[model samples]
Target: MTETHATLPPGAPAFPPGRYGRRREPRRRRPLLTTLLVVALVAVMTLVSVRLYRQYGDPNYDAQVITYTGITDSQVLVDFRVNVPEGGSAVCLLRARDRDGAEVAREEVTVTARPDQRQVTTQHRLATTARPFIGEVVRCRPPA
Candidate 1:
């Protein structure tokens, strides 16, 4: 009896022999399947990133805020410059923030480049609900 149960420590409860099913071996690690899954996930992420970039990313239309002046309780004047393809037009997003960094106003301004010009300077009077602390040109993109 001691030889049959030699692996158990003294005072440890022992189950009757063959009372339960045999224990299973540990499952083997499938490195190839894991590698393939990782590769597929990366491919999917790459595809999504490329699609998003193509849809929204642009290098042709760039904008900069030259100055923001005439701030008041009601409105602000924002002067900005946009670079577009020669003779092309773009729409730029502008934003105004309060001292606490809350958005006070936002608007889209459209600019067109002349046949021989790539940069266009323009200004917009953005109406606001409260006093604007600063104005900014967020981005520019070709008109939809």
Candidate 2:
């Protein structure tokens, strides 16, 4: 009887040998730290944009006095005007206020006028005498 065995070449693996079938090291990341970094960047950008806009935006105007003439029971003929530049539209926000500055009634009107023009006029019916008339300039813009 003759016995035979399998043979391998020199310097080659023999299936029980070196460095084969090794598990690779896992990569590491800090999830909490990464999320905090993203949040900080967004907050910084928002503050910068708000500051820049306020520096370049237009000036603000508050509402002024109310003027009324030729009053009647149901309707009153009144001239509404706002102090604005040439080629601008005046917005009149009408409201009624008690002596304590509390709002009682409210309405809004817009008027466009050229330079060196007279007051803008609109007629409105009185809703309630319990509230005194309050008028304010809301906005002014060029004619489109």
Candidate 3:
């Protein structure tokens, strides 16, 4: 028996060529300025969060003015609300300001927390050197 072999045409290629080959994708590089900006933003945000927590997040004490009425030219009655921890005592600063924004009277009061309550409402009288147009609580904090 004789073996037969395939032959190519005279003008045809000896072997067929493929239309595609292995290719590598382009590498992406992050911008240095953008990376630095992102890092700075994160750092600033972290610092701001910590500062805010330290300043206003803690549950030390709080005070709010409920009402005020002028009793006399130099006297006023103020009703305010105070919040503190259970069985805690707080010191609050009350101020009476005149129409010119000057503090005509200032006083500090100690408030005690009840065993079953976190908020307390009380009234106090303030004696001012001059007539006051407004009375408010300046601040309240746990007694040292």
Candidate with maximal lDDT: 1
The 0-to-1 C-alpha lDDT of every candidate, in the order given, reads: 0.88, 0.51, 0.83
**Candidate maximizing TM-score:** 1
As for model 3, its CA RMSD to the true structure in angstroms is 11.3
Q: Which stretches of candidate 3 lie over 4 Å from their true place?
A: 1-60
Candidate 1's residue-wise lDDT over 113-133, tens digit each? 889998899989999989999
Candidate 3 residues 1-144, lDDT tens each? 221235655664443334344334987877997899999999999999999885665565878899999656798899999888877788889999998999999999998878988888889999999988999998887777
In candidate 1, where is summed lDDT lowest over 10 consecutive residues? 1-10
Clashes of each: 0, 0, 0
User: On residues 70-140, what C-alpha lDDT tens digit does candidate 2 reach at each position?
Assistant: 44333333445554554556555565554567655565666655767444444544353554444333343
Candidate 2 ranges beyond 4 A from true positions = 1-57, 60-63, 66-81, 115-126, 133-144
Ranking by lDDT: 1, 3, 2
List residue ranges in candidate 1 displaced over 4 A.
1-39, 51-56
Q: Looking at model 2, how many pairs of residues clash?
A: 0
The residue pairs that clash in candidate 2, if any, are none
Q: What is the lDDT of residue 22 in candidate 2?
A: 53
TM per candidate: 0.68, 0.37, 0.61
